[model samples]
Target: MTETTPYDADRARFTRQALARLVLCDHAVAVADGAAGLVATENDPDAGPGGRVSQAFQLIELAERALVSAVTYERERGSSWAEIGQYLGMDPAEAEERFAADLDGWNTAFDVPYRLDDTGLKRVPQLPTAAYDPVSACARLDTWAGNRLVLVNDEHPVSSGLTMAAPKP
Candidate 1:
């Protein structure tokens, strides 16, 4: 696969992907909100307790995923665990543990091979999430980013007793 592309084209592609993701997220939130309302009101037998229970479960899952997404975004933007902990009214260690699922999802989403800098910072290139191939893409990233160690940090699933590895090149 060719990596070279005009900057404008790359930006346009990124814009489209981002917009799609945003729209989907908005729709999910709206659905979850509607479910919340339904669960709070109405008792029609056709859509009563059972339906409400199902909707409530879905809302919980959606809320969890949203929390993960938000935490991951904040972490990527260079927010420290202490900063995030303050925002969540928790200690740094508690915050890390609570957001473990979020960190795991973020790690999987961006698990392509990368070479971390001296400060454990890797300038990750924006890749299209569409048709994402973690294996081949990580191999390509290794070539582009060189051989450098990614650090064990709060964003890693390893912090939560999970292990991850870059795909074989």
Candidate 2:
């Protein structure tokens, strides 16, 4: 048997993929907005306001990605998300959420806690929430963001300890 290899798709192919994604996105959004539930528009449906919004959002994000990729590749063509969104009749947030799941590359960009600039001001990205202090502990971020907080201060959890009893036989 012959071994299989991965196939690479270029810009045109990527663009077609993006368009298809937009139609699906619009369909999802459309189902949400109208008084008619999703079933009403099941088989053959018209994409209405929500669909229009999603479509615009998709174009906005596609434009943004194109501009970003162009800037990375060509360097002459460059634009920000805000600019692209403006051209697409949407906003920065809309453009962002349109490509929300596509935002995998910049994940670790904010992972570093602090940075020292030439001016010597330290930039810290993470901040403490009601659940846990960002100043200490790695576990806190997960714990805090995951559920409702029973204890609201540093002392509560830090001071918390379990009293051991005999294990049931």
Alpha-carbon lDDT, every model: 0.48, 0.36
Query: What digit string (tens of lDDT, one per residue) describes model 2 on residues 1-169?
Result: 1221121111122222222232232333333333233335463357765875565566556555544333222211244667657765889778666654443322222233234566877443321121012122223322432333455554433213212223436
Worst ten in a row by lDDT for model 2: 126-135
Error at 151, model 2, angstroms: 69
TM-score of each candidate structure, all chains considered together: 0.44, 0.21
Instruction: Give me the candidate number with maximum TM-score.
Output: 1
Give a tens-digit lDDT track for model 1, residues 1-169: 2343333332333322232233234334445565657644445566855877777777777776556655665675578899999988999999999988646744553444233456866433333332133333333333332322244333321112212233336
Give, for candidate 1, the lowest lDDT window spanning 10 residues.
155-164
Best by lDDT, which number? 1
Candidate 1 lDDT at 134 equals 31
